[model samples]
Structure formats: structure tokens, C-alpha cells
Target: MVCGPDVSTHTIAFNTSFCHLRDTSAEADSKLSTLIHEVTHFDDTFGSFDSIYYLRESRKAVGTERSKVKTNADSLAGYVVWGEVFYAS
Candidate 1:
């Protein structure tokens, strides 16, 4: 999903895939997977969550992927894309 963010409220306008995932049955595996991916975006945009921290927690694979993405640290989209690559659902 490509999230459109509103800096005013720190909200993301979910793209089609995200809306589909959210509207689906909560117990569905795909929904859970989407939740994991989207939550990382949400938290990175609106909360104190840090991608590097979680990447470290996910161990070497995630950490290695994180290293490959060039992020600005202040760019939400960069972080989101990085997470999608390193910590995909």
C-alpha cells in the first residue's frame, strides 16, 4: 500500500490494498500480514517507534536488508519503503 500522510494529524490515507486488508475478516492471515506491515508505517509516522530498533530485534536478515535501503531518517516514505523491503509481510 502507498500511504498518503497528513502531517496535521499524523494519519495515513490507506491505499487500495490497505483498505482491502483492513476491511477483510480480522482473522484472515492476509489481514494479519497487512496489519504487521502497515502498523510499522503508522508507528514510524505517528509514534516513537524506530525501524532500526525493530530491524535489530528481527536479527541479521532484517538488519542486512535495512542496511541496503538509503533512508533520510526524516523522510516517512523512505522509512516505510525500507520497512517494506526489510520487514515485509
Candidate 2:
């Protein structure tokens, strides 16, 4: 998915696979999480977070990646996803 740096433009394009899965009612949990991940990027201030943030939240599992968790916007969004999903239920 490609999210435009300018939120005011409100431009977001989901890849075919993400669209297919979301449209077909597949991977419900992951789809929601991924949606919020994209939203995080969109909500980011003036696209300031993009240059340094990693897109793959899964990378947090790696020991080297752990050090950057505090600065990782993706990981922060992911953690929010998990927390929101968990508490909302």
C-alpha cells in the first residue's frame, strides 16, 4: 500500500492483495491491524515520521530491531493495534 505523505490530500492506495483480502473478507484480524498501520502513517505529522520509520512491524522480533522500538512508529502503531484489539474485545 502506498500512502501519500500529505494527509490533506487524503491519498491512500492499497495493493491488489490487500484489497482482495479486505474485499473478500479474508484475514479479518490482520486486515484490521494493517489498516491501523496505514492510518498511523497517514496521521503522522506532516509526514515527518516516514524517513526514519520502518514499515515492517515484524522486524521488532529481531534483537537488533529491539533497540529502535522506541523510535519505530510502525512498532508503536502495531502495539496500539494489539492493545486496541485486545481491550475492545
The digit string of per-residue lDDT tens for model 2 on 2-88 reads 444347665667666765444212223245655555565555432224322433433433345454554444554555654432212
lDDT of 1 by residue, 33-61 (tens): 34443444444444323343223333333
Candidate 2 stretches with Cα past 4 Å from truth are 1-6, 20-29, 43-67, 84-89
Listed per model in order, the count of residue pairs whose N, CA or C atoms clash below 3 Å is: 0, 0
The segments of candidate 1 whose C-alpha lies over 4 angstroms from its true place after superposition are 22-60, 66-89
How far does residue 8 in candidate 1 sit from its true spot (Å)? 3.3
- What are the root-mean-square deviations of the candidates from the true structure over C-alphas? 9.3, 6.2
Model 2 pairs in collision: none
TM-score of each predicted structure versus truth: 0.29, 0.47
Query: Model 2's lDDT to the true fold?
Result: 0.45
